[model samples]
Target: MKLLLTSAGVNNKSIHNALTDMLGKPIASCNALCIPTAMYGHPWVGPGVNAWEFISGKSENPMVDLGWKSVGVLELTALPSISRDRWVPLVQETDVLLVSGGDALYLNHWMRQSGLAELLPALQAVYVGMSAGSMVMAPNIGEYFASWTPPGGGDEALGLVDFAIFPHLDHELLPDNTMAAAERWAAGMRGPSYAIDDQTAIKVTGGAVEIVSEGNWRHFTP
Candidate 1:
């Protein structure tokens, strides 16, 4: 599986290039599915608009600006109302799975409920994750969030990757995103963790992991 887990979306040239390299083709020729399910729970605890802007990538959304032929939103929460067979193929056909950031627990719910988790291993599409999207790929979120938990009382993540990601470290606008907070969070983790700013990403391909950074990032264990 190919995955690009980022604190933010493609925010710099290095990340953009990493994405391009993974695609092995012009990004404009690709088809993208932008999942915004995580954003649904933003108001309860988040930066609101700023989170939206980062997820949306505004009018300059790299997928659009870079030339992805088809880009659309897939609300994972709505999966139950639709035919899974029909929707599952759409995921398989995409060149990219653009998962937006928001509440990790919320997003994890839809991923499991929607069967997206099951489909991921076989997916040829590059999995591009932002913030919460990146976090959900781990074994468990535990109290890394400090203020939240899954509604169903589970800390389990998708376990798509061996480690957890703590995003938005040291971001100026989001006061909670600091190195100190990251240190606290990492200290509680049961396994490896990565603390990354907006311009950083963790790329995993065929079991090899690489840190792609145009900004600050560090790996730690608790």
Candidate 2:
């Protein structure tokens, strides 16, 4: 399995370079399976247009423009009534799973309810996670926020990887309270944990994990 774990969006040129180096192609060459709706209730949750419009070249999502062929964009809200069978197969078919940033708790809940949790591991696609998408792969979801209330009152994660993933380590961009919450959670974690800055990434391939970037990383174990 290949994992490209990012803190936030691929906004910086340096970060984009690192990502392209890892993927071995320019950003535009890689076919993208974008899941912006996973973060917002719908892709249109942010501005006037929906996620599909943004990804399909109608509008622009800075994150998508950074790289990605924008082959398909899944809107979870419009298809609320549809079964997971209709969606999971689409996710399985992608070459790279580009999970957009969003609320960690809600994303985790939706993934479980939608049956994505069961289907993702079975697929051989490369998983590229940003923010909340990265958090769901960790052992628990509670670490991402200072104080949050899940719709169903649960904070566990999908556990794609054994370690905890701390995203958005840019102190200038994140609130002090949020950073403190993440730090507290990292301090108490039982297994291994990694704190990744916005410019940093943790790449996992062939059972080996490597930090790829010109940024700092801290490892913890309990």
Best by TM-score: 1
TM-score per prediction, in order, is 0.90, 0.77
Residue 180's C-alpha lDDT in candidate 2? 62
| Candidate 1, residue 62: how far the Cα is off, in Å | 4.3
For 111-210, candidate 1 gives per-residue lDDT tens digits of 9888888989989999998888889999877675624456778677889899988888888878987888888878888899899998899999998999
Candidate 2 on 28-87: residue-level lDDT in tens?
A: 777767776454642324434554554554433345555466667766554457976787
TM-score of 2: 0.77
Top candidate on lDDT is 1
Model 1 / residue 115 / CA error / Å: 0.8
lDDT for position 169 in model 1: 88
Candidate 1, clashing residue pairs? 28-67
lDDT score for residue 56 of model 2: 55
